[model samples]
Target: MHSYFGFLCLVSYFLKSLPQVLCQRTHANVLTNETDAFINRVLADWNSPGGIAVAVVRKDDQGAWNVETKGYGAATANGDKVTENTLFGIGSNSKLFTILATGLLINNATLSPRLEWTSKMASILPTWGLWDTTAAKEATIIDVMSHRTGLPGHDFSYKWSDDVPRLIEKMKYQRPSAEFRDVFQYSNNMYSVLSYLPTVLLPSKIPFTRYVKQTIFDRLNMTSTTYSFSVARSTGLLADGMARQGINFSDNPFGGIPRALPFWATAGNEDGNLVSGGAGIISNAVDLAIWLQTLLSNGLRPGTNESVIPAEVTEKVSAGVSVQAGAAQFPELSPLVYGGGAQRGTYRGHEILERGGSIPGFNTQVARLPFDNLGVAVLTNDNDYGSFIIQVIKGRLLDEALGLDKIDWHSRFKALALTTPPRATPRPTNASLPWTDFITLTGTYDNPGYGKFELCLIAPKHPGASRSCAALASNAPTILPGAVEADIPTFLAEWDNPGFSHIRLTHFNGNVFNLSTLSSFPANDSSKPYWTHGGDSSFSSGAYAEAAAEGRHVGIGFTGIWGAGAGVPGPIGSTVRERAEVWFHKIPYDMDFHLE
Candidate 1:
């Protein structure tokens, strides 16, 4: 979903020599009736299917690029048509700005990537308080940009009125899923909190907005882009500011009360705050082009025409540090990629880096083909519709402009979609035992460090707080760590995420129950019970011990201790499953932890 926000490929060309043509085409104009035709075709498609807005930019003569904008639909259901300068919620696409701004500080030697923000900032802003000593203090600037921070996407409870002081206070509870940088975990919480570094370092009373504006936006001439949600809303720059897409946005925690805007601004955790790496930022496609063009030129700021960030820093930003091959509770963007919210791939045979953003009525995609000095920035007010528009634009403009092949498969699929009947795929079942036999295995389990946990046999309507647990029971087994309990079926059946080579399920009486790897159990009728290797262990037991000793597999075991460590619980001792529930209750770590 999100992690591959930039990796998701809408279409690709079959042209083999596109790179050669791309090098030659530089400094040439991509504008013509042909370019317009391609744009129109895509715009027409967007209009019929209903899209918000779209814009594309390609290198023109003298290293300049032409930007084309089209407004097809409204931002909200009852909103107005999009305009060329229409502002859309950029979502995580704003991370680029944050990263670039941070890079500026590093370039000027004002900030150290290795310095501990908690220590230095604590001295400057004592009210910020010390973060959890566990793994929180150890996180560095590099960790946040690289998505190595252990904090989850939305681990801290945020409120609308919370200011910087609240964000610092929230950090005291921000614990890591593992040691700092141990694994690539995409964390918006980390990104938001990391901004504090600059705020505390600058002059005593300088606000973050002014600092960013003076350093990044103003330097780059991004006049329309803004960080203040309230300003954007008041200025009419942001469309449907407090709405959501795909599903209705909720304010109530208990389901009935209307909730205020979650107001991510309060999280203060860098990774999840309104301006965190996950979301926040309001800008138009025109302004985004100026931003993307700077990145394509390797940190060259607009207007002033100065190098805002060093070339080395630019290289570091482009070169991905974290590899999220298969992370649960992470985004499942495509069959092969996963991450926070964006996906990356190639277009017209040229290497392309891109990210997509969507929140209720907003959808956007930002792509750059640095090799060809070509980039596309699309901002829309609709969510999924932009995905299709992206495909059309890529196929029509990029492919034809580069003399490549268009993606006809998407068109073919759309045409054939009306005739294709939905398929009924049975759930995976473990023949060794019926689901009823495993009912006793469900209950609260307690561990020392990690805290309390549970696995209850819930009715379909009674899905609880463990987001992943409900997804496991539902037919949609897309095992993203914090996905709604209803969507796990998508992942359970498909080997889409990176880690899974293939999927196999053993069912009792033809009813799918137990899931396993396809390669491990080649034959379905084998009589032996196909127990999960180390990582799949329900509790810390002999299997877990074996895995730990070998260090070959990741097991689903508890982190903290509960009862006596010497022996297994007898009549008075509780099983590991019960202990797991207790740990769930005690521990408060983010479920959506992964690297992008």
Candidate 2:
């Protein structure tokens, strides 16, 4: 769902007008009650049904950290107030912890054979192999962590039955959008795979969750940051999540009316969460301030000689290994570059490093001005387009602190959001056949790496558009993807998977289908907390959400393959063959591999 092509187009019109407002700037100020008021205003202006907890921390003249943590708006729908300790899921900001843990392992004196950024994945991870065999052999820890692995996030491919091991074994099946090391392509699967390294390397061989809790969390005194929400909720401080329906870009500052989005069940006393290294974390502003303070203090606990992480660890994590996006229209922000887990570049000509994450309902922004010893953590329980609200708050504060010209973030965001729709994608050369031709196509489809899924037809709202695979058998269909279909569906293919809900597929032509679900499925129930896409524990969705929502572009596609070269992403330089999107193959009613 993440490709920012649409976002680029939305903001294109505003480029010519940037000079008009270049002179305007926000008055720099200390963190005070007035700053709290402005935050509440932004949340209300954005129509957020939930609140945010923000922590701004910086080192002072005495070289000790100064922290200001405050809460704004209602923590829950009924008006529970947010405070410094209100727990919220920090989403992919958890990735930074994973990266830091890797750094600690590298710095460990007792680890045999020693690991470094250049330590080859093939040597450490026996199961590590991609379509590009040579790339797999040569790819290092940095390549995978920095997202230079050439693979896009085929997020729905892995099932959690085997957790990280199954996720690792499935890598050869994922297709790459760019050549190896050629571009920045984000994939959570890689980070999850990194979780296995400690298991293989450590003498004690602890899992990632245990290692992180011991190595970093305990050292920093971040007592409340944990994977177990059961513990968090018991304190009655964990914030409930809320979200808007679809991406309805509008001139109205209000977004799609928000509904409650429930907290994840797996986060509470569950034995396994497959993507823990990638996204599993929940913390609040006050605790995260300690994290930021440690980062700003160069991996040491502020006001102490002790180190939570080695000083060189911060340097290693900050070195940019991949250029993420250069689409900046203004001079204030430079093209983004990513290293380890966070993104690093210049903001207002000063070096800045930041990253953001979101699942279904919550959004997180963790940023720092390393050179200036300043950091900010904003945990929000609402999701708007781009989680732009978090940025609006962060941008405003940073502009004031850095003494840069203040650009009207909200107006530009609103205007670009409400832009007239772009032209529809040109239809493919192949014409779509009648609805009758598509129903039997329903059944199990498989790739060795992605696992098997049964594609059954779900009933459509419009009787005229409905086709039934249920008639093929008396077996009742499982629960629908969402509450029910609203519009008449036509020749739709439906299936349930780990990552997406409220989704159906339209046959583009033949066996080719676009990824219709995670991109733009409408919100089913806005009155209560619910979300349609990026089902429970979907991490790092913010990277390509805007472009995918506006353009309805599907980087995730399914095309049936036949004949010899089926379901295989062949070797790197192999003849540049014109293979169909052969990621998934049609199988029989039973679990047989051969077609009927």
lDDT of each: 0.46, 0.66
Give all TM-scores, in the order shown.
0.56, 0.79
The Cα error of candidate 1 at residue 373, in Å, is 0.3
Using lDDT as the measure, the top candidate is 2
Q: For residues 470-522, what per-residue lDDT tens digits would candidate 1 score against the true structure?
A: 55445322222222223222112223211122232222132122333211111
Q: After superposition, which runs of candidate 1 have C-alpha atoms over 4 Å from their true positions?
A: 1-50, 60-62, 75-79, 110-134, 168-180, 241-278, 326-349, 384-397, 409-596
